[model samples]
Target: MTNDQRDPADRPRSWPYAAAAYVFAVVMVGTTLPTPLYGLYQEEIGFSSLMVTVIFAVYAAGVIAVLMVAGGVSDVLGRRPVLLAGLGCAAASALCFLFEGGLPLLFAGRVLSGFSAGLFTGTATVAVMELAPRHRRGRASFAATAANMLGLGCGPLLAGLLAQYAPWPLRLPYLVHLGLAAVATCLTLVLPETVRHAGPRPALRPRRPSVPAGTRSVFIPAALAAFAGFAMFGLFTSVAPSFMAQTLGVHNLAVSGLVVFLTFAASTVGQASLGGVPAERALPLGCFVLVAGLAAIGGSLLATSLALLVAGAVVAGVGQGLLFRAGLSAVSARAPADRRGETTSAFFVVAYLGISLPVVGVGALSLALGLRDAGLVFSACAMVLAGSIGIWLLRAVPRRPRPGA
Candidate 1:
């Protein structure tokens, strides 16, 4: 009997999409596990700030390369295989960190983590939604996104707390994640395959991101909003800790991690708050809120107020969440079923670019301009970009007629 023809009860334990999401979250936790430890790495390895961003940029490059080449592999090869491969990458990434000797290992771990995430991002999301009962598909989307953000948020918190108070700072976090990855691998093996295989596997190669021509109107705005929102995340992840340590005189590793956590936590809340709001409304509003958050963050930099920085992180995270979910939903809803994986991958390509490119600029600017001034410039540029997008969205999205008039 084919895998699909197997009895339902014979498959691994099922709970709508919970099993997939659990695996999803575990893998993602590994991706950002190094966030809080960059400072420690710097102390030990004696690298400049530019190297930090360069290391981070290498990870982004890996993600983009995978998305461009193998993003749709699950669509042909089946989700479970891709997921298992991703877990293998995660395991390898954890091992890299566990035995990291210097810059080479650090860079290898990050790029491996990127490859793992690139695989999981679109594949796991589609698997979750596909596995859910029809009625719960909407909730499944949220589940996938929440798992992504919450897992990303929790990594630093976990690492920060452990590194601050535990025995081994760098070694412990990856060790814990390695165990989690093992469990996720077992769970993924049992999870039923969502995509059916027909005959022999097709050769996978690099293919440009293609959205159905009809979906472009929806795809463009949503992708742009995602880019803007993720840029805020990239900034926080790459440089916020440094800002806290260097400028605000906050040296507590836990505090640094918490500040970053608050941003992603706020993003989760923002996404949940969208309940039934239309994308037309949510997208533009998200842009406006993001701009406000940027302005506040800029103000915090100028004033050197930690409170303001925390507040800005929270506000900006919320805005990022709002646009991220709304845009993802709009794009996923419009994408053709057969091409969902590639379309979703394309969307994430744009988002990851937003996260990587601007932050690299920040790192470069820090050399000539210093962290404070670099941050100020980034905030100003992002604010203008977000504000312009908001204005365009407002004009481009047609207003719905009043209920009766």
Candidate 2:
């Protein structure tokens, strides 16, 4: 039987997929909840900017590790178990934050968040898409992807507001998430399973990520587009606050959160814009736009203009939104039916690496030359990489006939 052709017992009748999408979003929301609060952590723990990146990198390390070892387990054991494991890790992460005293707890919390997200990243997207009726696949895709970006966008905004206005700056946000996660866990319990397997439970083992035969050529450009876009995410989530404080003289946590929020919001707008353009066109164009956004960011640093910074973030976010969604959608379409999970996990490993490695490089550079110069180097390198991807796509991928005739 096909993956989507499940028995009636496993099929949810009334919007279970929608409910799952919300759960997916909430899980993702927890992953970035620390973005705006990193500044406060630095104050409480007395760490360098480099240490902050290290903390975030730990989260990415957990994510990549999970992607490698356990990412495809959902296909065998069942989605519910994998998702429950993810949520459990998320709750543990929240607890770590609630009791956070120093770097160890902080690192532990982020690593848990990473594991949670890695579990959810491919499973939730595939589950939501498969659960939908054939006619509603498009809307389900939107629900899945939108939930991700919107949830990520909401994380900092929620945290920033609570941290700025509420007591227990570090504690309250995670508390709220913990409550939400409890509710989500209950909901997940009732949601019908979408993957049906009749064999003994598959052993969990470390597996390498690979593309299906004939898909490797397409996979490269798609992975590259996702990498470039996620690099934008790494910058925004990791150091946008520092940029605002030291470079632009802005200290409002809410304002800083809003800046990060706008980038993801712009990404959603970019995804919404994908309707008119073909995937091939959208993918390459999105990369080009990402390069442009980085150029704007480079200019923003040189000028010390907050407005330009915001503009760059929004622009880059839109590009990221378009490129990533387009790339994933295209790659999914080409992946062999059975190995789809492996293929998607591989793509995400690249994307998450983008989010982790480049930001660490920037953090290292900051310790040496300073934030502004490091930012300039960061932007220049991003532009070079993004530009190369765009040019390669245009040349390697065949051009489609223009929309009309």
Candidate 3:
């Protein structure tokens, strides 16, 4: 049978879907394991906090580079192959970290990890959605987001605990991840392929961030909202640990990781709360909540209050989670089916840009000013962006007609 005419029986099963989700989760966890370890690396390598942010930025750079070039390769080549390739990169990243003896090696390891995540982000989401049981697409979206958030949250938590209590702090965590990568690779091999393609493997091309025609109007507000939300996420992922250490006099890595994890876990909660809410309504509401969260975070930074910081993280994470799901669902729902993958990739490119660029700016600013001052600035800017988007979304997205009104 032709590619389009393949039997339905050959499609992926529920077990494979679950397996893929687990693999994606593992990869995400590995990427952020270094969060709690940055302080350790600082003592070992003698780099400044700015240098640490630079190192973190390198990872984001690697991810964007791969996304631009290979983001859509899975659409043509098949999800399993791309996923395996990602796992291979992830395994290599772990190995790089395991033996990292210097700053350059750290950069190299992080870059590889970023590339691995770049490959997985879009492919994994598509894989989970495609493999989900027909009746559970909504639930599957939650599962995918939850997996991403939980894995990210767990990374630091696991690393912090290990670093605090384990025999070999740096070496052991990556070694454990290497083992997980091996398992994920095996899972990828067994999972059924989803893409039905007949043409020869396409030559790799540069990945450009482009909105589909007619989507530009809606895409701008959505992308801006995403940028704002993810910028907040980037702050937590990249610098919040140091903030806890330097500003609040908190030196416990486990506690630091827990704070970061709470933000992401709360995001998972926010996303889950959208069961009955329409995407349009959720979009603006999410933005408003995000602004409040940003305000709280800024206040926490100014006051050096851990309670305020944690509260802000939880609130902002929820807003981000809600907006992300709503925005993605809206765009994906509107895109043409054939171009869905590309469009989705485009949306994420914007999201990840939000994750990287603004955080880099924060890093650069931290060099001139202090960390707390810089964080306050970053939080203020992000809040403004989110608030603007919320207002636009409110005006642009039509209110859903009430049932039997």
Best by TM-score: 2
lDDT (Cα atoms) of all candidates against the true structure: 0.86, 0.87, 0.84
Off by over 4 Å in 3: 1-13, 135-138, 198-209, 399-405
Candidate 3 lDDT by residue in tens digits, 95-122: 8889989998899989998999999998
- For residues 40-89, write the lDDT of model 2, one tens digit per residue: 98888788787778888888899999998887778776788888999999
Residue 6 of model 2: what lDDT? 64
* TM-score on alpha carbons, each prediction: 0.93, 0.94, 0.93
Kindly report which residue pairs in candidate 3 clash with one another: 68-207
Best by the lDDT measure: 2
Worst 10 residues of 1 by lDDT: 1-10
lDDT digits (tens) for residues 1-405 of candidate 1: 122323333334447368889999999888878888899999999987778888888888888888999887786778899999999999999999999999999999999999999988888887877776655655877888889898899888888888998989989988999989988988899888876645665666667777899888988888888888888888888778898889899888888888888999999999999988998789888989999999999999999999999899999999998888888878888999877767888898999999899899999999999999999999999999888988988898887799989
